[model samples]
Target: MAGHSPADGPGDGPGDNRGDDRGDGPRAACVLCGEPTEYPAEIAGSPLCPRCAWQQAQRSACSG
Candidate 1:
């Protein structure tokens, strides 16, 4: 761990800017809140902010 850290992993690091095997090209904002999304809008099908996603997850969890 002298020259790198765990956060230096593929997706965690900044080396995914070239649309590599991970297929990460350019990211877009959340369609609902206009916040940055982890993946592109197209890939996600619909952009969702973390806050909104968490809320949605909570709702979904409660559905059971």
Candidate 2:
């Protein structure tokens, strides 16, 4: 078989969100809750709002 599968089409690699479509738009909402966030939507990775960020930190802290 080939190195890549047909299902794994172009731009399907990890962290490949195809950000070019955003085109420098306004700030992005939280990826989890869809609330307004302070980070730019064009950022490479997901951006979380204040509440979500705090919640995520708490989850991580307690996981260990």
Candidate 3:
């Protein structure tokens, strides 16, 4: 891409801060299942693990 930089590309490997500004920070616990999440400690609001987040998304998608 013309406007993109190397940092905009895929993460080279582990410990790479490609997705967000938070880099290798502490992971947060999921509020529903008490499982560790990818979310950083400074992230706003509650965090949900991948499983719980998927379930929650399903519920929201199927709800009337």
Candidate 4:
């Protein structure tokens, strides 16, 4: 309960943009599946496309 805050907890609120666009540029590949990706966003040191990012978000929400 100490580490779980309703507002700050994972997937409990709006998505965070702080670490979304940490890449150098656009056009990258998904780190999870290694597929073509644009608007490259760094997630766990891997680039992810919008579609893959959405899927990852959903997964994270469910797991958290």
lDDT of each: 0.70, 0.77, 0.81, 0.65
Model 1 lDDT tens row, 1-64: 6989665666634555544332555667887888877776457478687888998899999999
Which scores better on TM-score, 1 or 3? 3
Task: Tell me the tens digit of each residue's lDDT in model 4 across 1-64.
Answer: 7787666745522355444443457456777777767655443467777788999899999995
Return the candidate ranking by TM-score, descending. Answer: 3, 2, 1, 4
Clashing residue pairs in candidate 4 (N, C-alpha, C atoms within 3 angstroms): none
In lDDT terms, how accurate is model 4?
Answer: 0.65
Which residue segments of model 1 deviate by more than 4 Å? 1-26, 41-44
lDDT tens digits, residue span 1-64, model 2: 7798755666644456753443355988889999868777667789999999999999999998
Give the 10-residue window scoring lowest on summed lDDT in candidate 2: 14-23
TM-score of 2: 0.56
lDDT of 3 by residue, 1-64 (tens): 7999766668755546445643476888999998878888778999999999999999999997
For candidate 2, the clash count comes to: 0
Q: Can you give the TM-score per candidate against the true fold?
A: 0.46, 0.56, 0.60, 0.40
When 2 and 3 are scored with lDDT, the better candidate is 3
Predicted structure with the largest TM-score when compared to the true one: 3
- Candidate 3 shows a clash count of 0
Q: Point out where model 4 deviates above 4 Å.
A: 1-26, 40-44
lDDT of candidate 1? 0.70
